[model samples]
Target: MSAVGPAEALILLVIWVVPAVVLFFLIYWAVRLAIRHEGRRVPSLHERVTAEREAQRREWAEREARRNTEAPDEL
Candidate 1:
């Protein structure tokens, strides 16, 4: 077989190097994403509080609607 020329060598280098660089970045991003949510629980403190408040507001609205629909008993 004949030896590769400069142009052929540059093409080969790019073919291998480009995928390697892309794979490296993909791995880096995966690791970063994993760490970002590491050691954390779902429905964190703030979220739990907000959810509770929303539920309470919904309950209050339902009670008010029931009161409005009920007929008043007059003497």
Candidate 2:
């Protein structure tokens, strides 16, 4: 059996390690992208419009109450 010198051993380790590291990163990126795309669809337009209208109505009501309190002279 031939003894492996330091340079030959190092080369072999790098060959094995580099491919494993690259494969790990590729798998990680693919899984991350898949998870991110999984939630791409959310709140239909109707739902979004309803939510916005509700928020605007709430704001308008608060403003009206504040104006009435400040203009007691009008009452």
Candidate 3:
């Protein structure tokens, strides 16, 4: 009910803010480490997606070429 003093307010701030800041850093570092680990194993997300799309394009092109060369009876 009464107004809190400066020392009490600081204590309360530390009790609340310290853990929050620590938690934020912990999550940030965890995500960074996970990304680094994945990057070591393969390319980044954008590069991987691009590479996959390119591969699919080439495969489709090859298939189309093969189909076009085949006789109508093969259809």
TM agreement with the true structure for every prediction: 0.50, 0.46, 0.58
Which residue runs does candidate 1 get wrong by more than 4 Å? 1-6, 9-41, 72-75
Clashing pairs in 1: none
Go through the candidates in order and give the C-alpha RMSD of each one to the true structure.
5.9, 5.7, 6.3
* True lDDT of residue 1, candidate 1: 100
Candidate 3: tens digits of C-alpha lDDT, residues 1-75:
999999999999899998899999999999999998887885679989999999999999999888878844453
In order, the Cα lDDT scores of the candidates are: 0.89, 0.93, 0.91
Positional deviation of 73 in candidate 3, in angstroms? 1.3
- Native-to-model Cα distance after best TM-score fit, residue 44 in candidate 2, in Å: 11
27 Cα displacement, candidate 2 (Å): 0.5
**Model 3 per-residue lDDT at 50:** 96
Point to the candidate with the largest lDDT.
Answer: 2
lDDT measured at residue 58 in model 3 versus the true structure, 0 to 100: 100
Scanning candidate 1 in windows of ten residues, the lowest lDDT window is 35-44
Ranking by lDDT: 2, 3, 1
